[model samples]
Target: MLTDLHKQLLNDFQRDFPLVERPYLEIANRLGVSEDEVLSALAELRDNRLISRVGPVIPPNQIGASMLVAMAVPEPELQRIADIVSRFPEVNHNYEREHRFNLWFVAVASTTDHLARVLDSIERETGYLTQRLPLVNDFFIDLGFRLDLSHA
Candidate 1:
């Protein structure tokens, strides 16, 4: 069960998260809670799988190279392959699709050469071929979600 604080933590910080040195303290002050409470609630949220991470969303390929990669993985091997891919720090997130190329992930690295090397390493480790799709155009996709907790 989520308390009001948990919902606020998720909803409020989706945008304009503090960039200050003591970010949790700032959040705690705004919420009228102690810094420890904010920290504890965040840990609880993560431990319960309500949230995956708290981090900045950089614009695609602005500071680094990124590619959308697909792999035609066998059904039985999907979980194993996904685990291997997720282990790479370069991979942001991966998901399944109902297509021949069933697994897809976005990989970001400091340089194009580094990105390619990471992809090559993934191919070598997973024993699967990767179809790299570089972005040709930019799109504005809103990635934030407001947790409507009125009924909760």
Candidate 2:
């Protein structure tokens, strides 16, 4: 069952916690709890896989460059290729998508050229060709949705 505290935390995230020096403290204050409690709750959520990470959602284009690279990973070499890709420091997130290009990953770089080079390195190491898709134009569409726990 989702506790009242968990529900409040989710609601707060959907509304944007705060933009301040001590954001956690602010959230704790609002929740009528101590800062330690707030921190502990967040940690518990992450440990239980309810929340991934509590951090700023930084836009790659604004700070640096990022590209979505997809690889046509053969079934036999899937694990080996994934291991090679994960070794690259530039690769932030990697996943297997339901498509011909099974292995999908994002490599954030200092620049567009750097991003390309990172992809090239992956191709060289994995011996798997990559299809690089850099965001030419970005449209930020907020997809934040509140989870329903009433049934629970």
Candidate 3:
């Protein structure tokens, strides 16, 4: 179940995230909670899949190259391939979709050549043809969400 603390975290930390060496410590201070408490709460939320991750959301093309990649894996090999793809450090978000190109993921690297190498490695390891869709323009990017735990 969602709690007020979780709501506050979801709302407050979505943007202007601390970039210091000890960010969680800074967050704990700001939230009037112990560092351990903040850490435990984040771990609980992640373990329950309430949030995909707790990390910086760098603007696209700001620091590194990123691409939306998809692969059509046979039903039997889906789990194995997904596991393989997820093992890469470059892969941030991966999910299964109800479409011909079922497995989709986002990969980011320091440069375009590095991004290509990651994709190539995934293709070689999984033997699946990956479709790379590089971003041409930024239409809309909303990484923040307000969760009302009061209703929960």
Candidate 4:
């Protein structure tokens, strides 16, 4: 269950996150709490799986090259191959989907060549071919979600 402070933390800071040296302190000041309290609350939220992470969502191709890679992994080898793919620092988000391409992930690298090498390594290591789909254009980018903690 979320408290009012937690609800405020989630809804209010979804955007315009403080860009100060002591960001948590800034948030704490705004929320009328100590910096340690803010940090502890965020840690608690993470531990409870109420939030995935607290960070900036950089636009694709803004910082580096990124691609959506999919693999048609066998059911028995899904977990093993997924683990191998997740080991790469380039692989940021990986999950299983209900499709022929059961395993899907997003990989970002410092350059296109680096992204290609990462994909190649994944293929070589996993012994599974990957379909790399580079971003053509961004239609919509929504990273914010509404958490109705009022009921909590």
Candidate 5:
């Protein structure tokens, strides 16, 4: 179970961890805790899988290029293919999309050619044809779900 202080810190700074030189110090000061405590609590939360990551989530097309690629991986070989897909630095997120192309992943690249190279490499490695779906039009969907303070 998390202490109240940890919960408060998570609620306050989950979206925006400051980009200042001493980010942990700033957060610690705001939360009335030591920088070490903040770091420890974050580590604990991550270890427990309460949070996926504690960093900036830059939107697609903001800096580097991104695409939603999927592959029709066999169900028996999903985990193996997923592991192969995760080896690439270009892949930031992966999911099992429910469609003909079941293995969906986001690939961020320096250029279009770089992204294509990743796709080609995956095709060669996994022997599965990748379907790259570069965003033609993006709709910003807010998937924000507040942690239940009542449970906290």
Candidate 6:
């Protein structure tokens, strides 16, 4: 169950999230509530699977090396390998495609060497070879989801 606060929080702060020492507190102030209320609501939203995570979405390869990696994982091993890949903090997200190289993901690191190390570790652990596709151009993709919270 979501309240007006939760709806507003989700809809208003998708972009231009306050970059402050106490962002939640700032949001609380803006919403005319105590910081604890905002945190509690956010926690409740997380617990109910209404939200996934809160973090900055930096441009790819801006502060580090970024790679679009793919793996030809057998169908039986897909879920397990995906779980292993998701454990790495460098991996943003992963998905499956209806192709031989079905498992695809993006990984970012502070440096090219660090990215290589992460890929190497993935290969060593999963026993699957990594195929990194080079970035030839940049495209802007909006990352916000406009929730329809009318029922809330």
Cα deviation of 43 in candidate 1 (Å)?
Answer: 1.9
Per-residue lDDT of model 2, residues 1-152, tens digit only: 56677777865676486899998899989889999988888888788888778766665688888888888887888988999999999998999877789999989988888888888888888888989887887666654666876763
lDDT order, best first, reads 1, 4, 6, 3, 5, 2
Q: How would you encode candidate 3's per-residue C-alpha lDDT over 18-111 as one tens digit per residue?
A: 8799888899999889889888888888898877789876677789899999999998999999999999999999999999999999999999
**Model 5 vs. true fold: TM:** 0.70
As for candidate 6, its clashing pairs are: none
* lDDT of predicted model 5: 0.84
Deviation (Å) of 131 in candidate 1 = 2.6
The residue-by-residue lDDT of candidate 5 on 25-77, one tens digit each, is 99889878899988999898888888887886666878868889878988999
lDDT of each: 0.92, 0.82, 0.88, 0.90, 0.84, 0.89
Candidate 4: residue 76 Cα off by (Å) = 2.9
Score candidate 1 by TM-score against the native.
0.70
Which candidate, 1 or 2, has the higher lDDT? 1
- The candidate 6 region of ten consecutive residues with least summed lDDT is 134-143
Task: Kindly indicate the candidate among 1 and 4 with the higher TM-score.
Answer: 4
Error of 4 at 72 (Å): 1.2
**What are the per-model numbers of colliding residue pairs?**
0, 0, 0, 0, 0, 0
Give the runs in model 3 whose Cα sits over 4 Å from its true position. 1-9, 16-56, 141-143
- TM-score for each predicted model, relative to the true structure: 0.70, 0.81, 0.66, 0.77, 0.70, 0.67
Tell me which residue pairs clash in candidate 5: none
Better structure of 1 and 4 per lDDT: 1
lDDT of 3 at 10: 69
Q: Which stretches of candidate 1 lie over 4 Å from their true place?
A: 73-92, 118-129, 141-143, 150-152
Give me candidate 4's TM-score against the actual structure.
Answer: 0.77
